[model samples]
Target: MSTENTGSLDTSLVAAAAGALAVMCASASFAGVLADAGWLIPALITVLAVVGVGVLGRRLGWPTVGVVAAQLAGLLVILTVLFASSSAILGVLPGPAAIAELARLLGGTGELIRTGVPPVPADPPLQALVCLGLGVVALLVDLIAVGIGTPAVTGLVLLCVFAIPASLADRMLPWWSFALGGAGYALLLAAAGHHRRWRRYEEPDRVAYALFGRTTAVVAGTAGVIAVLAGSVFTGVGTEGRLPGSVPEEFGGTDGIGLQPFTSLRGQLNRDRVVELFRVRGLQQDSYLRAMTLRKFDPRTGWQLDGLTQGVDANAPLPLPEGTTIGRGRPERIEVQPIGYRDPWLPVFGTPVSVSGMGRNWRYDPAAGIVFTQTNQETRPYTQQVIVPDPSPEELRAARGPMPIDPAYVDASGISPQVAELAQRLTADAPTEFDKAVAVNRFFTDPANGFRYDLTTAPSTGQDALSDFLFRGKRGFCEQYASSMAVLLRSLGIPSRVAIGFTAGYQDGTEQVITTEDAHAWVEAYFPGWGWQTFDPTPLSDGRTALPQFLDTALHPPQTPAPQPGQPRPGPVPGAPAPPVAGAQPDSRDVPQQRREPADRGWSITVLALIVLLACAGAATPLAIREIRRGQRLQAITEGREGAASTAWREVLDEVRDRGHQPRDTDTARQLADRLVTDHDLDATGADALKHLVTAVEREWYAPTAPSDGTLTDTLEAITRSLHHNAPLDLRSRLFPRSALPPWRTTP
Candidate 1:
């Protein structure tokens, strides 16, 4: 290629690099201001990496696709390597582990987005996603603006990125988000365009330079004007149920109620201390005591229980949701008594068929199974009659509802992009609503797919909690998992809501004394015939499947009838079946309690065993290390080399020692050689090698003017080969050479 062509290519790559940096800055600004700075670091890294690779590829005379591919492939590798530990284990560069790590990170990023709000400290997964996204943006900028010479097309991407943060609030960000991005994009386009024209002419012209400068100024000025206009128009333009900078007080925007409800929600949810709030009695089996239902979900804020409330009581038969099936469940009774906090919402085991002993101020919502008081209800005992649904997963999916009953009942348009996609992908294979619910429940509850039951892992407040839990977090207690499933179900056009309260607690014989630790949340899918069916996707510590609904079926493999015309009916299991009913609520019948988990045996013993092994290994490691250090110290003293030469000698000796040829404190040069010859079954050549190494080392250490010939190193190399062949069974030793480290460092 001619010098002119080479210069043009260089100019194009340089322009592309500039465009990438601009786009990276534009996109990363959102993460930086909304989230912690950790997210931006990877984006910066991506820009640098893209620039490096693009330049390299161009210089190497690669095609456009090759250059872009090289940039993407190389940067992806770098990102995977740099952050492998965050998402992967058994790190050996790229492998199954690396891919798993990448998937894990992406999944975690999704979780953070769903479960956490903006302004939280950026985690590894979030950072990785930002970097990966920036890499793609950079590649596109390179391809469109630089490679294709349509530099203006790249501005569209940068502008869209700039719009995100700008739209968050009235205006929290400075003008630079727009200015920096727009200026960089314009400069890139102008430069690339001008250089291409100049290259076509094969020479520089003053008039051409003047014309280019004029054009560049116009584009840059236009970009600046547009950015300013965009900021002015879109900034602080958020409406309710949208992604905004702030939400109303009712939406828990100020205190982060939607995602972080433990503040006033449950006294036990505190990090420092857990306070018992309530206790339950008169139940054959254990069940959760619900505080509230987040039926109204908004992406701008999150699922809110702050929606409109309706008043109902004894005189009013506690209005049931439309199309609710009656006799599908057996009647169960639970008595609740508040202790630490005077929580207004009533907690029930299942769908409240009837509520007795509550004051007149209490209002009921059939959609959420919520009973709230207009004023604070005193801490008093109340008994609730619940209908525990025994509908099969098939029945729930086949549920039919009154068309357009209430928009509030099936309202779910606010599901975030990440969460919607995940929910869609997860339930795509399943054709029915119950199948989707079951699929989602299985996915969320399974440990292998990156979900865990951890109360300590708080859902990040302010952002979409479901996305965060599913992708980035993977470890949250009931609230996150339940909300995630509920939102997914809603997105799939299935009515689902999260029930927050206490799970089954320590049974003090007849009375189950519920505690703060029992505080939990789970999804309840709205079924037409069975009403709201329970689906707890939070994996419990016990061996029992978290999906109690599916556990029995899985164990006994239920037989099913042929599919019906509309949708198949997954009726109640034969032995535990309840008659289909015609009442507004479930028809009362004989109820048998399900078995509960043993209080003390829920924690995993396998994890405990691993912990014990690790602790024991840690304690014993120092002592074992001390002995190794003593041997290495003695060996080093016997060798007695110093300075840089010592490093090389030590390296060679460590290799020899690692191959099962242990160094001895007493062995001299002659003794060690003899031992080596005997151990290796060395013929004349191997023996000669040992002899040569001894002579060379002796000369180097003891003689003032040792020979500078490379023979010394050569002999040591031969000895290394001999040791490898002689002790082929100790490959672990070669990988982890104990003697390579210094004495004090190794000696505990």
Candidate 2:
């Protein structure tokens, strides 16, 4: 083969790897999205399918369009069923109804994309949309960059994917995402543009090839830096890119989750780390600062807001509280400063009157009574002038109006009947609605009602979550207490919404440092004249996190990992802390509860070691079988009594099978010679060699006596070459010989 032809063989492999890297680059954006882990499997399948089909297409002589079309069809069928089918009604794959359901889930995407806040506790609709979106992107990158042989075009497609997510989110994208995307595009350009040295020409194009390589690297490197920098800068991977991409060690970086807020699903209310998110000054009393209020409740999906949101400019006069007599009411000028946490919303005391010395990204909604920023909003220090009202018990009782609260609060369409009944039983004594609300809040959080605060509890979703929290072992942190209180109050005709924000931090002189541990939620009951008042039904203190007296025998999320009477549960725990069972928790310091002993250490280790040895032996089995067969042929030569005949004949049969032909095991020495000579167009020398071997074996077996053989090694070697020359160079025939494998295991 020509030198150029040898290089072309290498080019194809490099191109295939480049194509996979391109898909990975685009899929890297998924890391910031909520369902990132779920997207990885589908993304991998897409890349592998593209490369696999491309290889097969080359062998089958298919065009580029055909290969692209085949890969697209396969990926669509796979991803649609994997992601969309399970979520569909009745679990049918590729139905119109399922497609419609997927569309319905994706309907509010524009708003979600615009908000750019990652909705944790994964929205099923959003998961489906992301799965399909990335699949299509992978196909486009594969076809345009790899199939069309212009890898430079892939940079544009990747840029669009990176820019949209980065513009919306302030969180930094991981550095590797940019690096991989760049490397893939550069490799593709090199493979397609200059690596095809196999095509022979009158003159070599060394200068042109060298120039193209240099150009591709410079362009690819530039694109990579831009894409990665955009995400990292937003993520507090800061502009300098010096901050480590991973969670720091002090913050339980063991599992990759750094300190985040209560905004995430089942918040990691850090049990240890003290990394301050921000600092606040002014309010001496415990300040409940609101970030994003989750008001709109859906039965199928839990807390989400789909209401009308109107935006006002940053410095614009925020609309005063409706029907408010509570103006500048306990006015507190709060000075806030950010440490490392980057948030779009500047945590401020709500019913925020005004903000100064901030960027233009901030916007306010009169309806929600909250101020948020969009553009330069990641943790900018701002001094907010807020009106904090503390209406007394007497004033709150008398506070009444036309009920300007949204009708959704009073609808109570999906509140659990158990919760409603419980509310009725709890509030039967209270004469007024305001008093009844207070009674309900106290009843739920009262330690006498068997509730305690534990950050490790698993939260439930949907309409009946209140029922689970109340009836199924009432032991959760602040979210359960707050959410249940709001639902129960709503059931009793009280207007309420769940407020998400941080609790008062540990004070340092005038300044208060708020850590991730302080993130909390509380219920706000809307009163006509007094406005929305925050209530804490959560018994944060004075109660051990252990479950109630009544629920000792009951099974809850926290207790799921403990071994039952007839069961032995193994493996590290799921998303809950160590269960208070089987000595998992210490029973006093001295002579603590003994852990259950595991089975048979010596026997298990021995068995495992044997299994590993057997597996290694199995891998080398082909080489072993080849050597054994060769030794048997050697025994037939020099040492054996009869035969130049048996040695020569066995060599010919072994060569034919090794070179990609499977002949009958029963064929005699002479019969094998007849077939090999005719089927393979062997020369006269090869035919003569085969004839002499067959005659010798026949004479040794059937004649009166065995003949001492003349040199038959040359004859056997000639026949072997003829067989090897005609055999196809497919992977299986050369490396994986039929002789190395058993007769029944051979493929046609």
Candidate 3:
């Protein structure tokens, strides 16, 4: 190729690269808006690919490897920019420590990958990788086709072949999808062949291509603008589908449990399952399936489970059964770990001694170890004491009595006879109600007995789910286990109910934040005399115990072993503090005391206002200094008899106004200068000098040329003297009469 052709090719490649870079940057910056505009990042990349091909064709360049590398680099740049900006892409990736500072400011570290803020909503990281891969492939095809002198029409056709699959891959696939999509796109592009359109050369006057390009640009710009406007409106409005408005009473209130109006039926069923699981365990203790408690149940809507009522007299006593032992022994420290949705209901093992730091509406249900809150809010983890009656083994073994079923519990007479028969058969060979309960608990808890834990939603076979679980699919989660237990126990004349809470799992260093994933269902049954008891028959065989796995790894990280077995352990480094063992409690003496200063309204306000004023002044200092430096530079240039002499003169006119000289809006620069000189008592020489400065400034401003340094120096000196002599006693004070001044400023 000729040198001219090579130069053209190089320019075209540069232009293409620049265009691709611009598009990538734009997409990254406004990803959310682009999503709203239906202009996905993948689509933007395809457009960039098209632009690249066009540039390649015009410049007559053909370097596939270079194009692919350029595209990849562009993608990396886009990711970096988006990550820096705290856009969705940043949330998707797990960044290195170097980006931690940036991540902190952007609030990007916690967000889920591929999703925007509220990290849980984003697509997985694997999906993002796929989209990036597709982008690279698309660019490669563009480079190859364009370099071969493929006609613009032919290339345009080939571009679409690659674009569609890339879009789908980005939308559907995780990391692997990108490769698959890229392969498909490449195949399509290759199939389009090297057909070149002769029409452009045959009809050089054709305006179709130009019109198409302009139309595309206009459409893209318009869509972008609309997307921005729509996003602004949505953000202003805020999220529409939020959770329940009120808190649950179990958080800290005397109110009964109430459900949110729109509580999903699926959630209710899940909760019911948990209650059944407890029943199957046959513990016969009043266990709380703590959820949101409602005090002020709206008669119309039923119950608005708000948060715990503020300021309930928690010191008051909870009603307990007569003859019930109070403080019979030291309270058992039950550490509850709620693993699922951060609901407001606080869970405990038994009757609580006292709930500390609970909301006002919340109250401890001493009879049943549970904390009640008035409202249902997000879930959180807490520790509370439970007065668990640990009866002796002899007492438990000798216990024999009728199961104290709740009066409200319906008997099997209400159900089909077969159900009752099935329950009898399940409880056969048990001598007492307690034995039967034990039998039920063992059957469900025994994983070898066909019980299986699954996360998939089980299909509803019929109303008698217990029968189905016992005979059909043994695979089910906590809900199925609990439900089956409850139904069978109730059938056998034992009063039972379901309890829903989270299983203790991951210890979040200090305490685990109960995620929604840990939702569990169990059974609670009432034993005569002993009161209500808790039982959980859900098989614990699964890796649910993996919570300690994280803890173990964190606490016992692998370290280099000492060469000699009897050698003393290494001591602390010269300055650094010794590292604490995993789960070791900090020394009480080392704990820092937080001292709070007494509130002083007047002093606080005054201090705050003064600080704010100082901050403003500090921020403005740089701008003030910049202005002063510019003025000095102008003065010096004028004095040197260089360019900008006239500009320096005009600046002097502005200085006159700054010294409290009121000039008419339409006043000429000369008029303003003359007024300043006359009103400020400037000498005739100074006054004339001011007028000459104005003329020079106006001339330089309108036409522009090198300013004479001498002229600039003269104008600066004249303006400085005039302004200092006529300095305002507070510029605003001179501008307005005392009576017209604001009252506050007048006093100061």
Candidate 4:
């Protein structure tokens, strides 16, 4: 290829390599932030590969070869990183032993969400490697089709498409994710090549390039800033269901029922149910179910519960119960597992004493045992710690007293008479109001004799749901049981309302994590002497009791031994050392000693000295070589009889000057040549020969090229003699008299 074409190709290759580097950097940075896995090594390798490809293009003068090499290298690096980081990134390592466990977990929740169920005891490493291999194949195919194109833009698009899916798949078919990434890389290379080809025929305008570069930088920077700000806001609100910077107002005036988390469809449904069921009671307090409190709301999503505002005071006290003494025991941790439906209202036992590990906006309801926060409706597991007052069985039994009828309960003007008649019939047999309340509770709780628990579907409306549950469909979920019990108690003039909370949760020794499937609603009846007490009208299953199986496991995970009274407890995990030991004294042996040394004699100083020495040595190497060559050239010039020796010398010096150097205005060609030889340590013969060549150049410029054959031959021989001997004049020195000279020169 012509020199011009060769240069163009090299430039294109450099551009392509730079584009690849940018893609690799973006991917690496993103992975670092999201994956938290060991992805650095692969990212570094990919970067190095891009650099290598760039260097190879420059050295070999071939863009195509460089592009191909880089694509292959990038593919390898991506695969390696995916495989190595799969375990940490996917949260599931491949192995036969883990496949069954993974399958169970995935099947339980993953299936409901449209994700593929993973096999039991999977082979994480192999899965990852296979996925990576496939990704490479896909990438190759894409590159072959698209050709080399704009690497950065293409890579970014690919990243957006792959991020979520890859993350999810990495837990199962990890190898598939790798394959997908490979495909992305290949597509980027192809796109970059295509862009280059198009640009060749239609040259890009300089203004456009500048505009695009600036625009990309500005937009990306702006987006990054916004993401950071929004993330910060989400972290602030805590769990009180309150938005940051917003003051809490009681819901619907004085009756104290707080606002519930109501962002998602499910949450909205729950809220509507609560409002409909309790609005007419007048005695119902403004109650809010606290899930996650948001002190920050995104301008985009508005104020929703997913955003968590951190740093709020989580320990603030709520309105207390009359004559209730607060206890200082360890808090009971509750975990709620998500079974697919998204709702902000988390159910818990009635009358929570205190709550811990929740957002700041969350307030406790001493009357109802519910915690609520304004949170996003996305399905995910949530946890919190609550203090439940320890009421002895005797206290609970003896605490029952006459029910005080709220004067507000006397009227039901707007309500249908049928509803009132049904309520009275349900509570009719009992004499005391308390007895009537128990009768209503027993009617729904008797599953074998009356009610049944079924989650197959929701109840249809039009006909009264209570009558249907009583006459038609004997089986029902918590909503039916709780709804029926509430209506029945209302019939007898005893104040009663529905309560929603998780029935049970998975146990981890002493802690319970409630899953979303455990969503339940029951009833609470007020007793004049004691207060409102929880009543689950839902019957227990044959294999289960009131408590859930998961709750039992969670509340009490396996435990390790406790340390002495003065010693600190072990870490959260079993058999782990305590983070801080009680009464353990600090030792002086662990202290580090400081050392003082002379700064002037440090390694940096030594390095500087060595560099100076090497530079001096470099300056001498060319001089010695020139001297040896000049001796040989001089002998040839002297022996030739065709031309004068002086003429030969002049011709040689002129040739040296022609390459790239010209003397200062004040100096003649010979003078300049002589000065260069001396400064650069050229030998006597080399210096003299250079001086002679300068004279020939001057002579030729003035006298022309009419020398005799003998003269020409002699001149030619002289010029050829030491053309490669003495170092040429420094280009910088010749061009700018005041500038420092280059270290060494090579004769052409």
Write down the TM-score of every candidate.
0.39, 0.44, 0.36, 0.43
State the lDDT of candidate 2 residue by residue for 1-748, as single tens digits: 5665543334444556666666676667656545347656655775676566665675577898887777776665555566567665466455776666556767866444422344232455555565566656666766654455444455556655654444334455557777777666566655543323222221235323533455556646765765665454334321111121122222221111111113321222232334466788887455677765656655433444334355576476666655455663677788888664555555668567888766666677665665665443345688888877755555666777687656866667876677688788776766666677777666654444555565444355432555655765465666667777777788888887776677777779888887665667777777786667677667665321222111211112234456788986775322112112221222111221212122212343335334543553564356345544554554355344456567667666767776656777677776767888777777787788778777777777788376556556545656664564554334444324567787654442
Better candidate number, 2 or 4, judged by TM-score:
2
- Deviation from native of the Cα of residue 341 in model 1, angstroms: 3.8
Query: Which model, 1 or 4, shows the larger TM-score?
Result: 4
Screening candidate 2 with a backbone cut-off below 3 angstroms (N, C-alpha, C), the clashing residue pairs are 4-198, 171-235, 172-231, 172-235, 173-231
lDDT of 1 by residue, 1-748 (tens): 5554543334444465567666765774474235457667677777777877876887788998899889877776777766884443444245677877787778876545432323446677777876777777777777766666555556555655655555433233566666666667567765654434332323334323523565455556666666666555444331112221122333255222246333335322432334455667776655556667667666555455645346456325655554475665667777777664444556666667677776666667665567766442343577887766566655555677664334565677766777777777776667666667777776754445645565445447545555555665566555567767777788887877777777776756666665555667777776666666677877676432223454346324556677878996775432232122122222122121222222221132234334443543453344234334433433333344342234334544565555545667677877877876777676676578778766666766778485443444345445554654555434234223445434322221
Report the number of clashing residue pairs per model: 27, 5, 97, 108
Best-matching candidate per TM-score: 2
User: Mind giving the per-residue lDDT tens digits that candidate 3 earns over 1-748?
Assistant: 4443432223223324433443343333223212242335544645564555455444445365554555555555444444333443445433454245333533432223212211122232323333444355345444433334221222222222222222212111122222332232222222221112111122222222322343334333433342233222323222211233433222222111112321321222232112211111211232333442222223122233343223233335444422244334335544443332333345554455554444445554433334554443323344455465554323433555654333533233344466567567656666566556666766654434555555433454754444455555555556566656665677787766555565543443454343334455666555565555455656655334222121123223456577588788875321121222233322222211211121222243335434543543453344333343343454345345445564465455445434444456677776666667667778766676676766667666675654433445645555554554555335233223232222231111
Misplaced by over 4 Å in model 2 are: 1-272, 299-301, 374-377, 456-463, 542-748
Better candidate by lDDT, 1 or 3: 1
For residue 141, model 1's alpha carbon misses the true position, in angstroms, by: 76
- Report the Cα lDDT for residue 136, model 4: 45
Give residue 351's error in model 1 in angstroms. 2.5
- Cα deviation at 488, candidate 1, in Å, is 1.4
Cα error, residue 480 of model 3, in Å, equals 0.7
RMSD vs true structure, all candidates: 28.3, 23.2, 25.1, 24.8
